[model samples]
Target: MTNSLKNLTSILLLLFLAPIVIATIQTPLVTQTQLPEEKKKEETPIVYAAQLESSPIATEITEPKKAFVYFTHYQEAYQPILAAKGEKVAVYHPESNITTFQEQINAQFAFHQVETEFLENYNKQEIKEYNTIRPFVLNALGHNKYDIILDIHRDSMKADVTTLKVGEESYAKFIFVIGGEHENYRWNEQLANNLSDQLNKLVPGISRGVLVKSGKGVDGVYNQDLAKNLLVVELGGVDNNEQEINRSIAILAKAISNMFFQPIAS
Candidate 1:
């Protein structure tokens, strides 16, 4: 070969070799920079919605049972019924007493009997707890072989509208708000209907109605399918006192207890 042709070939070889060395040297640095971007992704926030059976933990609890539970107090929707009728606003005050059942309701209401009992039994201690209700629910399921989870809460609305007379006694009306998307959705409705009917007879106007929320929302399902019987019941509004709420609790608890434990009609 001629000298000029050999030189041209050498130049071509150098050009190709230079890019490979440069890329090889830079590869480790490029990978190091990616770590921060990955860490940032880890910190990104996530929005939770229903029909979420994706997590590895989701498939662990699947069985049959009734769970009674309560949410940590998250709002001031119920303020009037907290303190005396004419007294100052202790609405946001710490709930020191009134555990198990509301005073009036405990005098009457009982929780539904179930294999999976979800009652926090905080007994009016505090409502705004964190991730406190369900861990116990899981444990209760373990202890008693329970399957469903029901967390109870009161509705928030104007007091004058909520307070009404039932026979000679005072009672607050309630609406059974059930999430519309759970597998047990229909059964939940049936439970609500049965309870509503029974309460209507036991304490009229205590049931506002059964509200089914089918749209996208957090409460449409309160982790009901740990078993198919899970449900959350919003008994009374905040304007109604624990005492007035108790009137409805009696029949409410009985309805729940009976449904959970009784034999299904054939």
Candidate 2:
């Protein structure tokens, strides 16, 4: 045949064998079993996980602080109907009953048993009650360096001004009265503010906020100069009954417990 026809046949034959030849050339390279260990490791799929199963988890629990509570106006009864002969007797004597607040606190916290009641109205005379109470507190402090001191009293305001409703319970709302005359006033204010915040969280409006007093018509210091955490808490008012005051007390105990107890991460 002609040279041109021969060349054409050769070109067609080369084209048909090209793929086979290319496959043969790459077969050994792809099928090679000897790969470096480092190269194989680089090609492996990564598996990520933390080995924290053995680690201990943290608990949100803590110990309570040492605390004390007493009524300076022990006989300053609520809603006085008639004035007694300088004895300061009223309708309700918180000293006789509401000492249960301190008892409740004792159940959940480190509380000093300082349920002192002065038969005479020491609160009547300018600073007589405070003077008497301060010495007792100083004595109490000598025995136990308490972290918190509460001088509990009922306010003279009406029920409407001092009552608050939390969920299904109606409570006598309380206020923290800070004596600004003391050098550690800020410390007392901080504690009061913290207690107020915690109480409001548990029962909104249960806290009437902190009231500051100093100078005329009132005992400014209220003997709060004795300690940094001393607070004069006015619980409810004249219209608040024993039950309402107790309800407030229970809630107050919880709030105080929470303020002193703090959780730490493990």
Candidate 3:
């Protein structure tokens, strides 16, 4: 048993065992490679394409919300004097006709069938002036949550100015009035602009455009502070008759329905 013979024997044994150790270490790597695709997918932290597509955060846009319509000035009727022929007589118009705009909106359209609630607190003497309608409006807002609140009114504009010809019949062109007094006035303006855009699409000249108002000579806020999408819509002029108003109402209902309930394509 010489020293060199002993050292050579030890080196050979070490080489033989090294291969075995390496093979043993490689066993787990082979097992992992041979694992099922499903099991591999489960163990991996990466999200799959299908899962990414179906995620709630990555979903499509939602449908528009329901709207509520009410008139603050319930007795604000169209003045008949403005409808008279000749040089468009601008006489002292003071007669308040009995027919209610609230009834007209409810009757002319199928709004009752849809997700629409109309506030009908009608009395000529009670909510007489524009200023007197705040409490009523505030009360309405307090009770219900609405995505849109339309303060429907007949404008003082002349018929010739407000009238718009759609197809065969004539429609009283409307204006979207957004109040600038609220903190979320931009949201209100955006909604008004969106509605105006939608209306103008159906009838080119139907919408007079969005009018943002604040300060003196106006109610300023117009109770628009209550909701983000509240709007004051002037339906037609003092001269526009019930027939014209009804036609405008029908068009409005169609436009609103499309804007809100219209489904997004999957």
Candidate 4:
């Protein structure tokens, strides 16, 4: 009686314990299989947060500064270039004039990521030409804001006064002419001084210096009274060829960019 009872009890105990042991092992296996999926869910927000942090970089892009360039004495031409074209004039030409510098200026400014707007139209009447261009300049200033306004011109002087040699290259020298008659002329003078300093720093002696004109028979205001940022730039004399002038333009554009834009990291 005792043996039969012992065997039956042992068999029943084994059947019950077998199911419990199998259930415990299978539960751990299910958890192990699901761990990767659970970890992926937990890490989803971190990946999304990284993308959000980087998204603002696209929107943080800065716009370039703007410059307005216009020619008051647009008919002023280089003698060497005009002579090559069979023109007899030493300083003045109806076409092939100082206004042609606008192309090189625009290209150099673009390379530095500075935007330039040039106004080249003007009347043929050399007398009171600044008066004729004033309305157009005022109109341009009204429509758009400019960091600087340049009235590009050519000097009537000889090449000795307007050309500079830096290292081995010859550069057409420039001078900043600001009228001192106006009430706010000092501001224009300061701007000219800053630009002249930058130019000379880039290419030693490239800038002849800032000239202030205010007296009778000198067009004392030179239309600079209209804006604090306006000034006349005597680019070169009649003798400087296109190559020298173009090199100077590149230096000037770089100076302008250095003044207005953020410095690039080394």
Quote the lDDT for 112 in model 1. 32
Candidate 3 lDDT over 203-226, as tens digits, reads 677889999998988877877887
Residue runs of model 4 more than 4 Å from their true location after superposition: 1-62, 120-128, 262-266
**Among all candidates shown, the one with the greatest lDDT:** 4
Give me the runs in candidate 1 sitting further than 4 Å from their true place: 1-69, 74-78, 85-91, 96-132, 146-149, 257-266
Give the winner by TM-score: 1 or 3: 3
* Cα lDDT of model 2 by residue, 1-266, tens digit: 69999999999999999999999887856434666766898855332111111211222333435566777766545542223224354645534434434444443332212222222323433333776678777767667667678888778888789887544456788899998887888888988999998888767778999998888887778878888878899888876655566566666766776665645337
- Number of backbone-clashing residue pairs for each candidate, in the order shown: 27, 0, 0, 0
Local accuracy of candidate 1 as per-residue lDDT tens digits, 22-129 = 998878555677889999999653321111111111122233344445454534334554445444555344442223353333222222332233354554344354
- The candidate, 1 or 3, that scores higher on lDDT is 3
Which sections of candidate 2 miss by over 4 Å? 1-64, 78-105, 108-128, 263-266
Sequence-dependent TM-score of model 1: 0.55
Model 2 weakest 10-residue run by lDDT:
47-56
Candidate 4: residue pairs that collide: none
How do these models rank on lDDT, best leading?
4, 3, 2, 1
| Candidate 3 wrongly placed segments (more than 4 Å) | 1-66, 80-99, 108-113, 121-124, 129-131, 263-266
Clashing pairs in 3: none
